[model samples]
Target: MNANKTLAIGCILGALAVMTGAFASHGLKAHLSSYALSIIHTGVQYQFWHALALVGLGSAMLRFPSRRLGRASLLMIIGTIFFSGSLYGLAITGMKWLGPVTPIGGVLLILGWFTAAWSFWRPDTDSVKA
Candidate 1:
């Protein structure tokens, strides 16, 4: 995706992270089990961090456009959807099947970070020298 889109997604996800965190603590506190709350909290943490990462990636892309960074942003967005989305679904709906998807998301998140680093380590023709 483009830098502008990445920035938009990052901002939206960041907002969602904050809202989710607040909802979990206030609205769901008494309604959810501690384990469920913990799951949501974990999701919020990962989502928040990745959201920030995407923002950084977007900002960097504005300065130095790179396909690798775009790929990293995509991975992060999809991974957050899978990881945090599954956690939210599992916690709220008690769906056990969602548990298996979390690891895939985690792997994607790891790959995104590594890819981002690699993108910086070896700048492409489109990217500025690091």
Candidate 2:
């Protein structure tokens, strides 16, 4: 995706992370089991971090304009959506099928981080840092 779109998505994800965290802390705790809360906690943690990472990637892209960074940012978006999304669904609705999807998202998150690091090596000529 383009930098502007990515930046907007990052911002949205950041907002969602905060909102989800608040929900987990205030509202979800009462209704959820310890295990469910833990699941939400883990999801929120990863969600928050990746949201910031997405923002950073967007900012970096604004300066550098690297395709690799764009791809990395996209992966992070996918990861955040699936990873956090599944946790929220499973914990709230008690659906077991969603559990399998979480690991896929985790793998995507790992790949996103690796891609970001690799961007330094296979950087676009237009990249600011490169």
Candidate 3:
């Protein structure tokens, strides 16, 4: 994905996370139990961090458009969807089936970070020196 596109998505996700957090705190406070609220909070926390990571990934891509970085960014997005998304679903609906999905997302996130590290470790032969 293009760096600009990745950055845009990251910004959007950050905005959504803030809105969701507000909604959870104000609107859902009365409806959900403390436990549920905590769960939702965890989801929001992970989402926010990952969103910020996306921004960093975008910046890295702008400086160095490595294929590994692109793949890592994609994996991060997927991780956010599955990890945070599953937590949100479970918190709101209390469904047990979504439990399994969280681990998958976590794995994706770990892999994404690993890929990013590998990308940095291996220098690009095509890059021109300033």
Candidate 4:
């Protein structure tokens, strides 16, 4: 995907994450028990961090446009959905099965970071070295 598209998606995800956090804090605080609230908090925390990662990925794409970076960003996006989304669903709906999916998402996040690191370590072929 292009830098502009990546940036746009990042912005949307960031906005939604903030909205979800706010809802969890203000709307669901009283309704949810302490354990559920903690789960929701975990989801919000991961989503917020990944949202920032998305912005960084978008910036990297604009500057470098490496395939590795693109893959990393996509992985981050998927991880955010699976990790945070599942936690949010499980917290609100109390479905135990969704817990297993969270680890897979966490693994994707680790892979995404590794891919991003590899992208940064490679020389920028588009740039003229002095």
lDDT of 1 by residue, 1-130 (tens): 7789999999999999999999999999999999999999999999999999999999988888898999999999999999999999999999999999999999999999998999899876546443
Query: Which has the greatest lDDT?
Result: 1
lDDT of 2 by residue, 1-130 (tens): 6678788998898888889889888997889999998888888888888888888888878877887888888898998899999999999999999999999999999999998888877775536443
Which lDDT tens digits does candidate 3 get at residues 35-57? 99998899899889989999999
Better of 1 and 3 by TM-score: 1
In order, the Cα lDDT scores of the candidates are 0.94, 0.86, 0.88, 0.85
Top candidate by TM-score? 1
Instruction: Count the clashes in each prediction.
Output: 0, 0, 0, 0
> What TM-score does prediction 1 earn?
0.94
List TM-scores for all candidates, in order. 0.94, 0.90, 0.94, 0.91
What would the C-alpha RMSD of candidate 4 be, to one decimal place? 3.1
Per-residue lDDT tens digits for candidate 4, residues 27-110, read 999999999989988988898888888898889787777777778888988998999999999999999999999999999999
RMSD per candidate (Å) reads 2.2, 2.5, 2.2, 3.1
Which candidate do you rate higher for lDDT, 3 or 4?
Answer: 3
Q: How much is the lDDT of residue 7 in candidate 4?
A: 78
Model 4: worst 10 consecutive residues (lDDT sum): 121-130
All candidates in order of TM-score, best leading: 1, 3, 4, 2
